[model samples]
Target: MFPNNLAFISSNQLHLVQSSLLSMLKGALHYTIPLTIITFCIGLVLALATALARISGIKILEWIARIYVSAIRGTPLLVQLFIIFYGLPSVHITIGSFPAAIIGFSLNVGAYASEIIRAAILSIPKGQWEAAYSIGMNYSQALRRIVLPQAVRVSVPPLSNTFISLVKDTSLASLILVADLFRKAQEIASTTYQFMLLYVEAAFLYWVICLILSIIQQKLEGRFDKYISK
Candidate 1:
């Protein structure tokens, strides 16, 4: 009788795990993945603009970019999220949870990735710029046609790492009721009182997603390597 009861309990637990997995996956698919993609794309644009501004030889633009990067790097991401999601309403500017999360994440990414991009652009030799100029290329034309393309190859690996980190960072959205993967896990755990199991499962899902991203990153790096001189 005890063995039969054990089997019954095991079956119920398995069913619970399956249901929880499905629910969390739905959250990931519907929210987490989309959020990462959207925020990263927006962030890349911001990063490029900020990096260009810093290197543009204009004192005002450089100062603005410097201050922006410094502010973001000095603060914790959690604080940034709270300020956007919770504090914004005090100024009568209310943002919904998902959009707020996106704004916070994109700005954070922009600040950090701008440094990476700026470094990559600088790493290109001065001769490359001179060569472009010799070919009658203006500064903008040289950057667009020559410098930025090479910088992209150097920047890919670090940018991929940033993207992977962003995937995990999306869990922060749960704090603001974004109903992402971690939020789904919290919901399930609260009802079943299975916090350990649910949290582990949620972490496993995040690991899988990051693992896949790492593989893609490797593939991208390999593709970019073809252009590199031996």
Candidate 2:
């Protein structure tokens, strides 16, 4: 039989866990989720533009896109975030923590996702473009009407993966003083000295969020597959 005091300790621990979970969830709802959605939407636009530029055959655009992608891919995301949040203040370009996180994550996603988008665009047969031209479609028209639709189907899986990754990466924003999910956990743990429990709780929340996203990704893939098959 357990000691009577053991029950009281267990109850206290349970209360702590529940309260910590609530605080972390609030942080996630307020910052982590919103940041992910906003950054990813902006990143997708940047990715599409960069991908288009790379394939545009304009030397200047290609060079600019290439350098941007190279620079982003070569650096660590944490370093990028640091540069935006910490390093920039020295140059008199001080951005707030949330905005800095958004810019850093968006730029990182844009660079990596551009490559995925570019490959998807390239995977479409030359005949598709030729067929679009034969049907009186200009380059822009073909891209808008024929090519991009097909490329989107190809890119969905990888892009979904990228979004999932960005969800995890948002934890890094804690370092920049964004009160995201992990940051909330850190705050609670520091007070309670329950570092392991709080950190695991945070990880579990992340896993749950990612699991839901994975399900959504699968559904999206299935929907796109049906369109492709038809």
Query: What are the lDDT figures for the candidates, one per model?
Result: 0.95, 0.96
Positional deviation of residue 163's Cα in model 2 after best superposition, in angstroms? 0.6
Q: In candidate 1, how many Å is residue 196 off?
A: 0.2
How close to the true structure is residue 84 of candidate 1, measured as C-alpha lDDT? 94
Cα deviation of 27, candidate 2, in Å: 0.6
Question: In model 1, what lDDT does residue 91 have?
Answer: 95
C-alpha TM-score for every candidate: 0.94, 0.95
lDDT tens digits, residue span 1-230, model 2:
87886545466677988988889999999999999999999999999999999999999999999999999999999999999999999999999999999999999999999999999999999999999999999999999999999999899999999999999999999999999999999999999898877899999999999999999999999998888799
Residue range 4-65, candidate 1, lDDT tens digits: 75546466677888989989999999999999999999999999999999999999999999
User: Lowest summed lDDT over 10 consecutive residues: which window, candidate 2?
Assistant: 5-14
